[model samples]
Target chain A: MTNKTEKKGFSRRQFLKASGAASAVAGGAGLGLFGYEAGKDPRTYRGWENWEGVNQVFNRKKYAVDQPTCQKVGPTRRVDARTEVIFYRRGSFMRQWREETGLEGMEPHIQEYYRKNPEDLELDIYSQEVIFPKLMEDRKKYQDQFRLSDAWSNAMGAVSPPRITEPPEVSDFPRRSRRGGSTEPVKFKDPKKTSKLIKKIAHELGSTLVGIAKLNPDWVYKYTSIGRGFQSDEPIEVPKHWQNAIVVGTPMSWDPMYANPNYGTSNDAYSRSRIIAFRVASFIKQLGYAARPHTPGTDYDLMVPPILVDAGIGEQSRPSIVVTPELGLNFRPAIITTNLPLHPDKPISFGVQDFCDHCKICAENCPSDAISYGDRVEVRGYLRWQVNTAKCLNFWNSTLGSMGCRLCVAVCPYTRKSNWIHKAALKVTADDPTGISEKALTMMQKRFYPGPEPQKYYIPSLGGENASYREPPWWLRTEDFIE
Target chain B: MQFFISGWFWFLEGILTCLMVVGLKFYMEDKGIPMPFWKWILFGLWILLAGFTIAFVGTSLGEGEPTAAKLGGILFGLTSTISGIALWRILLTGRNKT
Candidate 1:
């Protein structure tokens, strides 16, 4: 019976009524939206304030850890299956680099490889097209990116040892306990407390994260890469004193990380991480425990990711490295093998498996199309998203200025810096109870953070110029600030 | 009260609401399009959604999440708000039998 014009007028009473209803609906939805995850995390997760009080805002659930992709659960290979020592870098063209100090030709190593495997064609194409041209071009003109990349490496290399060996800092000369001056190793009545102390000490020594895992011979490498062009030929065995392996991690600098697929970020994180490894190893030695640090550049006798997963460092992602809930893809791990009594942490899951299934931002943005857009494939004894490391490295060599391409790392939604809004969005997406949020979140990620043409990152001759995820920092590239 | 306070709801919401109001006014008053009552509600809701997008952009920017994401979001939110206003103008022009 209400007149049409009166209805169109929107009376004051009707406006107030609609406004009250909207306020009530919005309030109720907010209470429900936020109230769901409250009081769930009984433990007060410390520091890195963004993750603090996160539960009150976002629904984050830390589920039980899953088995790492590298771990061949329920052993299939015997101790002496194929004695010629599996070189982890066998496929990587890095093995072909001319010298211990990189940025050189791989002509001789590539010829030797063809002699060994007549069927190997991937590296053949890579060398002919990418590496040879890069080295030839390197002589003519040195780009600003390569110069910046070399500067970062040289800075780190200033402190780097020639080969992988125990740092002098990890000596047992002061083995006598400060409390008792006892020559005997300090004894722990409870392994749990020792584990806690180890973590506390590692954190105090500037470790971003610390975890312990039992030594798995399966994760140990047959031969250790001591330095470029030098790897131990004799079988590197996990020593008897090395019963527990401590995995410590630190996040990469976000400033440089924003401009990844460039030289500024990766080694910067590793330099800090490798030092943390030595410090933790030294602390164990001071406790009269034998320990060995396997650092980032050339010191590892173990597969870092599998051991990191074994120690509950993080869950494996589509890109194959472990991603932590706290740091996401912006993390690097350093391991220390020791005889110290420490509790092992179980593998953890933070919903990466499901999230990566739907989100292909990394694969889509990879410059050389190296990251797989296909479904997870079973390779070796485990399943993972297989990437052409040769193509990836070739892109690294061909990138206008740098020798490393972290395009995949830079574009990943998980590789975000720790902030409150990201915290909430990531938490909901990780919990992903409805399954709808994952798809919705991925859609939003693509829309808001849309990638440039992947080809834009290639060399000029290769049909693209160096368009980056974000511009490199001003200090590194002199042109940015120069008059 | 505790949720809104520690959770930074008011700070985020209060800023975003002001942005939404400004965004809606920026578009709606351009040609002085006479809004129908229901169209006003739809226009308001669309502007509110765009505010959410802006809030998301600012939060992400502070976190080193991608520069492209921030720029795209600002572009998309402001453009979409104008499109929302234009949508209503088209409908009002459609009622041209007078």
Candidate 2:
């Protein structure tokens, strides 16, 4: 056995030398040395330099392309399905302004009043909070009367059985062609006529929110690394056919989602992104114009932040998430870079930068501490809060098995549902004219959506398929983008 | 030489060990009081142990003399000891609690 004194004692000089040596070894080996290499990412914060070589080991970088290009447009149409458009009525009692003692007088008698009038009840149900408990009671009574629990059975007092919308066919897949093929950019007979139609088409394609923005050169990545269609530079002189870009966001199902923030809980986000991209791409191609979808799974050509900013979707927040009015940060974005020539939505100034200045909720709840509570700094042309991708990626690698983490998206305040009441306040706060409006909105959001408290870490699971808490599979590589 | 030089060995070793620890920890943390200190110690020990285990298991099952068998022995002993200690700590902790 070694002598205890010699073996156990660690000198400051020895520690320093060891640390320096370790960092040097890590940096040379392509590991970020505890995120020391975050400096390499133009959009990242310096504080993220903690996890040295983690970024190299776990990130799915093999998919990275040296220069990313759009896929070839093929012949396909979008499959449409009649689906329930869930309109959520947030529990009014849960709102901050109201105190709930469950008292008789406090129970909004307005529900009982509407129950008497069918015409009034339908109107009230659209805008006002539906009496969920009453509905539950009525459902129970009906079930007991008919002695039926089958959702498809109308035998119960239930007037109509629950029905799913008809799903679209596989033929609806979007057409693809190699970038700049024989397809002349679909010409719009009139620019004014096209923009309005494009906006309307975007909504039908399952985009909860859509905005048109002029494509800026800065928004395009300095270089592309992954995905289909290869272009080295901005195609020299831009094609006159392509002009405006459409930014779209698909919201996640809040019920299955609010339960956890682990990667498994985030499967819904990816699935939604795929669905929206597939549908939106098909819709654009059907219009006989060129439209390319940018999804995390599909591309490295364009940056989402710039597209989102130009489209006026939401203000960038401190946790480095896009904060939209309706979904907060809970949405996964899909971009359709097109030449349809549409009216551009001006980026709005929602004191989001200032709100994020004071709000560190995501940072507080981040189990990996990937988020920074630090002030925003200049990156390229814009000033924004940047996370340590190395740290974030490392945590994702550890917790999510293969998918990586979406807890930042899960816990953001902007991710709240856009209820009627919330919409009213959002409309007022969207402009954020004076800094005062932003301050008020932040206060209101803080009051309504109290930030998560720090507690022991809990690993949220996605039930069976992705239950193994293993690192990602070998295929999905984020490291291919690192170099 | 190529294996270690390429860093694939270390990378694979680190990843395997990390996965094992994190996977076990995920299941274990939910069961009872978190044995934080013991877990930390076990975490360090397993890296050394698992690394050698991979090297050793490869050799013993294979047809040739293990060129890295000396280092392989060290890895095996370290892994065995660490796993034993980790199990021992867990058992002892559980026993004391009971």
Candidate 3:
């Protein structure tokens, strides 16, 4: 045979004996997978079927917040002044029709009701105006029961740095410093005295949610890099000047983030957080103060549970992460620290704990089985749900190419899009705090919605050339547009 | 002897590897060879290293020295040339009819 023919027709036996052995040696030396055995073959692609570990790597113990905190953080409502009214009534006649019909309709009575009771709709007689205030009152009343502090109230009134003159006993908590205190000290401060200006600036920089809280060492991991203040042989002392933290959250786009599970989706989220961190930190620095942006690669400090809870952003849920009411687990967070005085937002509770007690969509959908199935257990002086970090991380390592698995977050019922119908159920859930909310949520998941579908994997760089799952650019082809 | 090899060439190897992987995935798909998970694992590692190499070289090539993050923003651009060339070649060749 010719040389080309000889090479093309090479036997598997000969290939195995010569090149395969060499490739195995090189693969072992390079990536450290065990040298390929003669008969042991490996499967190429299992896609989401073999994917596990969505919860493990991210939900590890040191990072896990208590479950009640998760619940408290999850159901937080956006306190926008612009509220929508679905049903309106004019006077006793409209009220009687509402009682009689029990539904919204453009009946003559309803139309007359709208004409007469436009002011009543403004008054929001049918719905309570002070739901947030009521929830805050309830949260304060049950603070110790929930294993929380009154950090929100304390962080208010802080416009300038906490000087020797302004409230000397800044509520005795020896945590990290405000400005990388000697590179790694606790920098948490009274949530009350944080800067409203900083909060506004953070919002301008794309932060939809913001909060402030005092630092706590226990909330931080037991150990971290010396640069990060988990624990170091170096002497740990709280900074004298720096106190108070500004927690900022940038909500992920609900549509793309929920649909795409991999880093492609999350990388964009992380990138946004990094951007917000830079902007907020820089703004503080411009005001002739010290501001540190706590982000993944940039910050020198560690983020504990306070950033989520103290901000009234969301509650911690079954997956041991803060769940926002509007976007669920579809957001990334960062923190800024300085001496700027500002008002801190109070912790919010919208019945997420009671809601999660009956809802386990995330737990059911976790491919790695890393999320817990048991009841809330106490860990690190707080009762909370816990996930197996090792299992989650292993799954991440296994599925390197496909977007890192986010099956748990994707399947979360709370992560659904905001619509009027859902708002009604949520309002009732907030009012009751009973398992009715959970049942409604479950019914919504089971009866109203289709089951979880696997996320698709396609190479973005390859675009439409490889698989046809590319996100089409704005301009459609003439053929596609015509159809 | 090791110093004789250009660092740019290491990066070029990475760029070529990425392009070849793309080609291989398409080529193998047309030929019906199921790609193993290791191919993807290798893909991630190579992409990361290539990114690092670009940042390191780009920093030294500049006046103030660019950060890895800044370099990361443009690493895809640099690789786009080779990948784009490969894509253009494929476009010119028309669809593979395997």
Candidate 4:
């Protein structure tokens, strides 16, 4: 035998010496008996087989206003307008700060970024301190390599609606004119029927998830932004007619989204989301109901996660993005406000909070270390794992293209793609009364799916190859485009 | 290390070690070889380690981490089984009269 290493390491006699000893212990515990059968799985939610956590509507029957699940999330608090992070160009926190502090008072190096993008939510002191300096340094250090990264991101396609301040005309389906009280509004005698129709319309319009929730004024931004943009100095109030909200969510394209910070644009899913919102809002308006679509990135008036929770879309996970059992963290949303009188869906629970508590893969894989490693904290009266956005945005802009990162989104165990096998695993994980399967599954993710170190995604010295979850698909092929 | 698991090299190693350990026991018993008390305990540990490695391998295959996790457990499991067998053999040759 040419395999001397094996031959010399263990002779036939040596093998005989060991197996005899092993039989005693191996015989005691037979290997064939300790597995599970999907058919006989004890995990059923309300007798729903293999659909334990499949739907996004976790808002259980007889929904609790204060506590969605057995877990006490604490007293719910409305987001204060004064402290809310406003990303609209006119109402941006940086815009307010610049108006008050003046650009002359700003650091000269970072003044360029704000001047170029005043409404950018990430344009803050952290960008000035950590991100801009790195940008300037990378600009000089890896000129063509940096350009290549930008080209690769651009080749995947630019995130649409480049400017946050784009007028409502971005939606081609605008209402004919401002609605008046002079005409009797078209009434849906049965709100439940109308809601069902709206949901069907949303799906037909390409929504992956849709739900009706009464507008929670607490989630609405109070100060810098308004229900609509272009309002000047006067503090604004939500119009009385802005009552029921229709939240439409779209899943991000699978291959590109799984790539995360490397080739993925965090905003890609939102483009589709916003389109669905525009269509749904237009449908409501044509039916003679007052409707206003809050475009995802460009024109939303409120923080999204809480409203998503209220709408029964999903529960917010550790990264603070709402994770539905259907799409996990892969959903992007657009909200339409109207007085359409739809039956409101209550908040849901399907063990997302519980799954998040045990599965720290997102926290462990975060490139920016932006995701919280600690337990959920009560912020503004709601319980959540608060992401340090400063750390997150800094890592995002530090990358060459300034394409935002979704490393958290990509790594989240809940973000599993829907398939029969994954669905079975998810159901087991969701309804495992013993929690044994969840623990084992979490262990599998932690052990088998190791990703590269954080710096590999952005650090020019490292060449960023290991950054993607898998290689870019054929269209995003680097060699075909770059070389 | 990664390749060993990815290629299922460790599973081969673990299974071979387990067979070798168990095979040696029957051989000794067939020849009426008088192993000492401490050697018997050492022999039991070899089987125990191999049994656990096989259990992890079984669980990994069931849990849908078929390649790296399953093969990796088997690979490292071989190391533990080999060590137990080696220690058991050393105990058999030891000067101590237990």
Candidate 5:
């Protein structure tokens, strides 16, 4: 047999050297391009700074508060002012829907699904045996210190809202520093400086993304539900003077999120956000302002997406969630409402709407088909793509394998790690404004990372799990230390 | 049975299987074997089915065993299948291609 290498006049060692040199050149060129796209400053591509000035120009132009989009009062009402979907009212739907479905509730429904498919049940069992116990242990260790509420205990009105009894206490030092031992508010004359300082403080205290927004009454919930049963429906009266909101978002780990819809990574992200929010709220309170932290497991006074949008943190996407430029949908936001004087950020327009319009990946991948494939509709006064909440919740409740279905968040092309390629694509899409760059980027994403097959039962593999989670580093595993 | 009960042993078995498959692929390529892509895919499917069967049988028979043992059994089965599949694909791709 003729030797292919000799026939081609290239030895293996010579070929390897040539290829190595070529790869080195290619790698250098790629890094150079990435450096240029990232900007001259190294900090622009590092940590929370990636979001700095990301969609500033576009946001200032299109979705600014003074813009026509914000000016118009449509049929679906602006999210900030929409009063129809109160917390208790929304909670009531779970019971009503459970009756409608004729299933006992989510647990029974999940049990039925597993019973029908023993193989899937086996997979679930394997995960429970291998993965969930450790996750639960970690959660138990951190639950008291990190989480302030237990809204996730029951998705229905059975545990609608957990009550907050004590008011946020201001620090003794700040209170004593004031004249006559009375707490006098430390006022900032410059809103811009205050906003910058607040953002810096938030970032330092573990916030992945932070922004400020002028408080909108429409965002506040009409009533808060505290605990289950009759006493749950308590009317909440938020003081109008709480004029500014400090919005902070913490990004979840990509590895576990990619691994499964609901996992330790998702829960950990929420816990971390709660801790960050609590600290931020306490910090604001020390400044002599009443600051209330609103986290995932807490009763929310304000709708998060609109507040995030108005804060210039992200744009509203098709899944009816805020998609940040830096983290995409892989983030959980916590809000701190305060009377602190701060300048609100302009709402960004980073072509998320355009990208979501073209990429129906989320809608297609939705387990229960809860996401809408159609154009943006006026729902509760906001002209945006609205998901079928009932259907979405039903899926969340019924999924025995996972806690919640974050398939949309997991599948989003934008929800990628902070790599240069993704960053470059983001820059291109943002700069174009027109859908041209977005279309190209979407196409590239589809080609490279094609969406997972619909309804394929994800069994956590024993050792060779393709989407398995990385063992969390020592710092994250707080369970190691006994309290 | 003793090997199947040990998690680390199963894990080691998976690694060894993976290494062996890799070595086989390299050896086959050096010997100029013209393995088709579809054949590799078919072989992978067979390996996957075999792995599934091993897991199913092990779990069913060792009902009283620790959950970790069952998990280890399933993991070893899966690892073997994945290793085989990966090797088959690597071999089919050849040295110049992928």
Candidate 6:
């Protein structure tokens, strides 16, 4: 054995030389991966020229001029007032049960699971035992700190209901005398041009995406209970004269959205949308027309998702939320019902349904198994994948000191940053009308970015020190607008 | 500090580890020693797995104060020490036999 080993012995000096050569090769490979070009300023890499010239070669915009409009596969039906998730939660029976038994109407299995695995109940206990109690004890202060946007939205709730009377006439406004006035409604001469202008204004007022649809009566709720709690059983009727609807979306920042089950981060998108919707409604009103904005924390007669679909904004994904080409499910939609004559957009189909069919990441990662992995089914007249709302709400109420769950938004493949690599993939997926590329794309996504692991939220920066709910940034709070 | 939490740090670490393993293999070959290629590969994989296991267990058992970076650093240190001991054994075995 010694003789055989001696024959294969290597000198230290020779080994050192070989190691140096290998190091050089490795260094070269590392540099190659960066794809750095000589004499090019990296800071100027994102200039318009790069986007229009070089980037366009790889990322052809996926929109087609003559793509067929998407069709609703089933007949439309009004959502039953009793069946609505929020209404059911607010019902006296459920509220009384929640107060009597601290279970929040959770299933037996979920409570049992928590009881069986006490160690895994850390978050649940911390939320229920500590955070929620403190928040409730000082409700006003906590509301200001944690739910500033919600409070503001609630304050603006009076505007959400249709006004009983028109505003008092301004002296300077061009108008006929009231006694023998020309009562003819003002005609918008150019519908297409006016629609474009409205969209531009909405975008300027902080809407991420803006689309118009001829108001579908089926999308309107037959009756809606206003405000929190079941104080009055009176149902508000939606007026039929509001013939057009403007759907607007605003995106939540990724940092907060990624920190799911957390209150401030998860609800920031909703708050931002509320602010935008209010401003857009005001703008529309100034154009000599009636505009009623439906915002978060306010009574709403319209179902937002179906309206968004009809407006050509996005398609509903597996989690029963609209996923747009630009932002996936990381945005909130608000509606402005108006009688303004505007050209409505056709419903768009960019292969989102096919991609969602193949990619069940959201369903798999859902803590409550609330998201469905099955095919679309007709529900209340719309053919779509529906989530188990009871399971989802129960999970939300039981964890993380917050009444929300954004796990679906956090894990969506399309919720990636708009970098070059993602843009390329998106372009390809959008162009593949037949959805033949979905399986390969899904595989690539999994390989590149693995699913979230257990106890993944234990990082100190994400949870302990900087874990306090994030306040809205100055830009979000300030009223200043750039021209 | 942000780099540690960001995904890029892991990518860089993976590239560095691969390079280190390649260099070690080349060094053994140049020394005229018939490389125990399978043994080296197994050792590398074992170290990686052990490091990951330590991080997972440490974070799981810890009160919510340990960041991913802190746990990752602990894993790196522990794995590096083990790898050094392993390499020493290999060198000693090779030299003494010769």
Model number with the top lDDT: 4
lDDT tens per residue, model 4, A143-244: 454354456545434544333453333332234566542333676779999998999888777776787788877676644434344343444466677788
- Which structure is stronger by DockQ: 4 or 5? 4
For A124-227, candidate 1 gives per-residue lDDT tens digits of 45655566686567436536545665576567545643344343233312355568754457888899999988888777777777778898876775544343
lDDT of 2 by residue, A175-293 (tens): 44666434345677776677667656655555566667788655554322231443332232333433667776565445333333331243444444545665666666666566566
TM-score of 6: 0.57
The CAPRI classification for model 2 reads as incorrect
- Best first by DockQ, ranked: 4, 1, 6, 3, 2, 5
Candidate 5 error regions (>4 Å): A1-72, A75-163, A166-182, A227-235, A262-265, A400-402, A457-483, B1-98
Chain B TM-scores across candidates = 0.46, 0.49, 0.35, 0.51, 0.42, 0.49
Worst 10 residues of 3 chain A by lDDT: A38-47
Estimate every model's Cα lDDT from 0 to 1.
0.61, 0.46, 0.45, 0.62, 0.56, 0.56
TM-score, candidate 1, chain B alone = 0.46
**lDDT of candidate 6 over A180-252, digit per residue (tens):** 6553456677999999888887777667678888888777665444432222244434464478999876666
Query: Of all true interface contacts, what fraction is found in model 4?
Result: 0.25
> Positional deviation of A155 in candidate 3, in angstroms?
37
- Please give the range of 10 consecutive residues that has the lowest summed lDDT in model 5 chain A: A461-470
Off by over 4 Å in 3: A1-194, A226-242, A262-264, A297-300, A400-403, A452-483, B1-98
Question: Candidate 2 A-chain TM?
Answer: 0.52
DockQ of every candidate:
0.08, 0.02, 0.03, 0.15, 0.02, 0.05
Model 5, position A229: C-alpha lDDT score: 19
After superposition on all C-alphas, the RMSD of every candidate to the true structure, in Å, is 9.5, 26.3, 24.4, 11.6, 16.1, 13.6
Q: Compared to the true structure, candidate 2 yields what TM-score?
A: 0.44
Considering DockQ, which of the candidate structures 3 and 5 is the better prediction for this target?
A: 3
